[model samples]
Target: MHTTTKTSPIETKDLVQKTVFPILFSISFAHLLNDLIQAIIPSVYPILKENYHLSFSEIGLITFAFQLTASLFQPFVGYYTDKYPQPFSQIYGMLFSLAGIIALSFADNFYMILISVMLIGTGSSIFHPESARVSYLASGGKRGLAQSIFQVGGNFGTALGPLLVALIVVPNSQKYILWFIIAAIIGLGIISKIAFWYRDHLVLRTNQKKEIVAYHDLSKGKVNWAIAILLIVIFSKFFYSACLSTYYTFYVIDKFHLTIKQAQFHMFIYLIAYAAGTILGGPLGDKIGRKYVIWFSVFGATPFALLLPYVSLFWTDVLMVVIGIIISSAFPAILVYAQELLPKKLGMVSGLFYGFAFGMGALGSAFLGKLADVTSIQYVYQVCSFLPIIGAICYFLPNLKKK
Candidate 1:
């Protein structure tokens, strides 16, 4: 819903045009809670595979189902919220996540688990676009830093998932997943507060804060072409990520004969570095401009990624961290760039990019899993190592810097 205040741009600048740190941190913490719950699904894949006597292809399907559901709905959600602006949508999203996690805890068969994850994915679809819009609304002129604060929470939560699953779910039992209900309860409360903030802020803020005039100078065909190029960059980034996040644990376990728990620790280390990289990405984008960060973040990781497949275990751990940090920086920069590219369509842009990123990741995980079944997980890593080279297309993007 578009709320037109009588407040002029100059007046709005004085009254509400400053970054609201309280709102930013609160919503970001809620994002952390939401992703923490979502990450648990992949984090426990080993347990699911072992308990169900499933094949690698089944693991891929599970990811496909979850990510597909998550990705397909986001643009719709974002587009709707852009017009309708449902402040309490976050609460509803968390409630769905709660239900899905609870169902997942007791799921007995493959189909049931898939259905449960779909519900969880639905929750994510709703949560991300809405939270991202709120982050945009709260940005005040520091969109990059605000997005960084919001995104780092999610990466941190993602890093914690496998670590927590290893400590609690693996040693105890599958039912331990129910304990995350506590996280959901806390999330509900947090989102409720955020919803209140969103409701209050909606009327005060302008509909589209940042103007994307650069793309306007180009023809519509050129704008779409640039967007397609960015999507390719996203595909490269998330697909490579799918190879690592979903398969790295299995890879280390098979190669080094390390226990699953040990492998998860290495994944956690990679994810922690990933979180650190995300924090730096947005602020750097603000200071240096998104093009440089976007280009460097993805391709910059190439050397480490190439080295990873041939490395020893200790070196593997070190390389994974380096790769994680560099690759993880791409998203925040990529996202804010897309939002700027289509400033009037902020929700649509956010949803489309976020949705496509998840969808590509799903395809990557499923396709790589099938490839692993045909060849080997080690070979999958070797193949995916070349994805970052796709970042070279970043050279084709026009400079978006203002004169």
Candidate 2:
């Protein structure tokens, strides 16, 4: 009995470490590469606008196509993979992005640019749902921290995108985006290896309910209602994010008369703060409870965001960093809370939230773009400043974490 007990504990420990970190970090690195490629789109928008003689509405349409493609396919992909897991599918998704990047490099007109981004968007749709499920499977009950680790990678890549644009893509022609093809290739290789790990550890999938199942007794109606509220929080978060990602550079340029590179750098400041927040939100949720993190991340940003449209150039930069950090923290908490709400449907829940976030971002960018055209980019910021007020929805979310 003594020998058996000792062996079992040792075996379990070995299994836990092997299934969790190695796979999580590998998948996280893949996310980094994937998002870097995605970030390139917004980073190069100034050039796209100039090359295409695009209207603000047209620039918004580019995001519309990309986000629609990214959003619509995610839930379907998540649902299918939940039934029949596809470990290598991510590599294929990356290849599609590679094709899109190549086409985008030479895209002479608006339609071609749309096609290129749609393909990249398809890659994101395929990548996120599956990767998120894998993260959950490998989490070993540290869902929040694992998710944050996974997110930080993508956030890091996102932070890099604008910096790359400022240093490389801004001075060069459209063809410079082709440099990211190398990142896609590296991602494909990493995800291929991750497929092997996922296949090897498919046995671990059975334990997914261990953490959340105790609290899962809530009615399906409650789950749906909670999900609806969570969706609103996501809408507020990503829509505000879209205003920054899609239009902040233009806003800076118009208001401060900054050069394109200078505006891109300011955008990078916002994104890096966002990346930092992404890294912290997950782990903080794990420790202090997802609910508190949700409330803090969402409502906490309100004052900062509200101040942004009214601040001076120096304060604008400072307030955006505060807004980015506070606001972006909400996502990790929100996603983990939703996952626990419907523990059985991790893939579906993740896909829906991720998809909804993408959809909101697209819709906001397009809607705000038209608004900017009608009013002004500065007015759009002022309008979006109030989005965090919707975080009151968090007050309604049930705390799934048992005391």
Candidate 3:
């Protein structure tokens, strides 16, 4: 006698043609948890500095260690995964992060801290490319909105990190960082479920007819040129962003003499605006063309970013919101544009952009830390303010919407 087997309801539909909200949100929430855990490293910087009596240079080195490990491994991971997709791989990433978190909580020396963050960074390197591929697969052709949903969760998590650090780890002992392991546990459970869905989805796809592939009309050389320009734009955006994200609290503390908690609140406000901007970026890109959003998101922030350093505390806070909104929108649009440019290489494209962004932010943090050591925090802002001006080059990119 033959046995009958049951299939999931999702398998009945052409998943490529239908937006999978459940999976999109599941992966997005997983992204949120993943980034939240990662954000702990930056959020606890003040604490780390105070505890260890670390210089700005040392602080920057810590960030460098973490981001270097995170950035360097991603492209290789994406390339390998493209050939052999691993549905449960994110679980291993989470385990690495968990180990890092435990190590960080108990870390005694500077080198130990470096090693711990490097482990966490490794997990991040593993997480982003795969999660991004899952987002693309679940997009149902609404790539922008899907990526936005996936991205916004991470932005929101990043916003929460500083606030949580202020409330939890800052006022208390460094050992309190162990509290974050709960986030890891929850993330592991979520990614495990996502892995099952991912496995089933792969099986379904193998059994189904081939899906239509998308193409861009630009020549390979033009495509390569466009990619190079996008990387330049990424450098412009993320490097400046690193200055704010890594040092804004110190800037405010030095400039305005605010306490750590107060400065953290301010950081939370700016990051909240950053997260809100991510929501509008993707859907707007779908409607008005990603090139326009990319151009506007990057260059449009120039005036505001330029004015930020010279303003009063009140105006500085206001400009943070404005700059956050405008600048944060560029990434979603940029990633989706690159993915469309090389539709067949989603994993590679995502890994490259994400890795490059992390690398730029790391270099910015490290270099600016040394700069701040030599000059001042305010000087770092003045130098970084010019970065967004590079966005003017976006005018040269071909309009994908025209085809």
State every prediction's TM-score relative to the real structure.
Answer: 0.94, 0.94, 0.97
On lDDT, the leading prediction is 3
Candidate 1 per-residue lDDT over residues 1-403, each given as its tens digit = 9996576666655546668899899988888888899899889999999999988899999999999988999999989987888999888888889999999999999999999899998999999998998888788867788899999999998998899999989999999999899889999999998888888776555543743233446677877877998999999999999999989889999999989789889889999999999998998888888888899999899888888899899999889888888988888888888887787787888889989999998999899989999999999999999999999888887666554
Question: Per-residue lDDT of 378-400 in model 2, one digit per residue for the tens?
Answer: 99999999999998778887777
Candidate 3 regions exceeding 4 Å error are 1-13
Clashes, model 2: 0
Runs off by more than 4 Å, candidate 1: 1-12, 206-216
Candidate 1, RMSD to the unseen true structure: 3.3
For model 3, residues 1-403, the per-residue Cα lDDT tens digits are 9997865545545655678999999998988898999989988888888888999999899998999988998988888888899899999999999999999999988999999999999999999999999988888888889999999999988998899999998888889999999999999999999999888777776666665667878899999999999999999999999999999999999999998889999999999999999999999999889999999999999999999989999999999999999999989999999999998888889899999999998998999999999999999999889899999999998888733
Candidate 3 residue pairs in clash (backbone atoms < 3 Å):
none
Badly placed stretches (over 4 Å) of model 2 are 1-19, 204-215
| lDDT score at residue 326, model 1, on the 0-100 scale | 91
What do the candidate models score in CA lDDT, each in turn?
0.88, 0.87, 0.91
